[model samples]
Target: MNAPRLIVGLGNPTDQHASDRHNAGFWFIDALLRHYPGQMRPDTKFFGDVGEVRIGTQVVRLIKPMTYMNRSGQAVGALARFYRIDPEDILVAYDELDLMPGSARLKLGGSSTHNGLRDLTAHLGTPRYWRLRLGIGHPRTLNPGQSVINFVLGRPSAADQQLIEQAIDRSVDHLPVLFRDGWEIATQQLHSADPAMQAKKEAKSSNPKEEAGEKARRRAPEDA
Candidate 1:
């Protein structure tokens, strides 16, 4: 039988870093655990909490490396070697500032200047692994360095937290699809318009009478 595919989530393991924007990977893993409570118990061999789920004949292993975010490759490389898993079968989920909040993109290769990814590539000797980039969104001007750092380390605002939480929940629901249908189709389904957008579209397509009624409702009595 073939070994299970591995899904590694990169993040620091500390209360200070728990809710940070950079810890979206951790948040995603937590979301997955909540969704599959029986699967992701702590395992010392993986250097963190590890869980397993079967997808037909394939077994998928979920890993949350406890070596901290910066040196995540240490734990990840060790686990991969121990399990005899190839880099191609590994999927990494991490935060990316390039994308907007509530958005996620999955791709291969190393396009951005991410130290964690660079380190992983160096350790694995290739950039062939799958990456799920969860966007934390870029910062506004005025002290950009501090802003970026703060974003990575600091807790999000209430609204941002809600967005991130919702995204995390959505990610949990879509993860199986990711493993089954591949990234492209899964991404389309994940990032597609929300119910609000669908409602607006439906409203726009209403009969002419409804449109006239809406317009009349917007007008003053005299104007109507």
Candidate 2:
């Protein structure tokens, strides 16, 4: 693959879920749009918000699927098929629970924790694409009783949120390398750095309210 032609950030589209941990991919896209100053409009054919960004002389298509998160493949598959973009020439960004908060990593292949990725893999029909994992930390680290769904769908503490922002900004700063220098080079640079502005992780419980929400989400659908 040459440079990535399409970049998709996974998230739910509702305003209510805008600041949730699961929306980190959307936040990354929002940050990218702000940096590039492009028009991202809703397109029914794509079933999502679509835009173009020039990263190192390449005009890359950006996608933010409005099809919630579970069926995000519908949007991704549509665009990929339309553009005939190979699975290799694509990148996806989404939240990760395995890494501790304030950390981020770039890699290829499947991260099984994300349902959005599951859909993308099924739709794209390959696991050979690049991925950016914005660490969200595990729920068990925050609180033992906390469920995975609640941890991902809930908003992080203000301090933690700031750390996430720093991670996003740091990733954006490495875009030139990410697009122009190939995934391996970009991954090395991104994985090696310690985030300079990453705020401190908070010392607190996941709270009783979140535990309740956790049960609800588990009973409901996947909140990728």
Q: TM-score of each candidate?
A: 0.76, 0.84
Cα lDDT of model 2 by residue, 1-224, tens digit = 47789889999988899988999999889898888868689999999999998987889999999999998989999999999999888888899888766777878786585899999999989888888889888888875799999888899988889888888888888888877787778877887674532221111123666667667888787655
Scored by Cα lDDT, where does model 2 land? Answer: 0.85
**Over the stretch 1-224, how does candidate 1's per-residue lDDT look in tens digits?**
12228888888887877878888898887777677644666677667778776654566788888777767777788788898889878888888877656666667676557767877887787898888777677776322566677767777777777876776787778777766776677767776633334566588667777877777888867785
**lDDT (C-alpha, whole model) for all candidates:** 0.74, 0.85
| Backbone clashes in model 1, listed as residue pairs | none
| Candidate whose TM-score is highest | 2
- Please give the RMSD to the true structure for each candidate, in Å: 9.4, 11.8
Off by over 4 Å in 2: 195-224
Model 1 TM-score relative to the real fold = 0.76
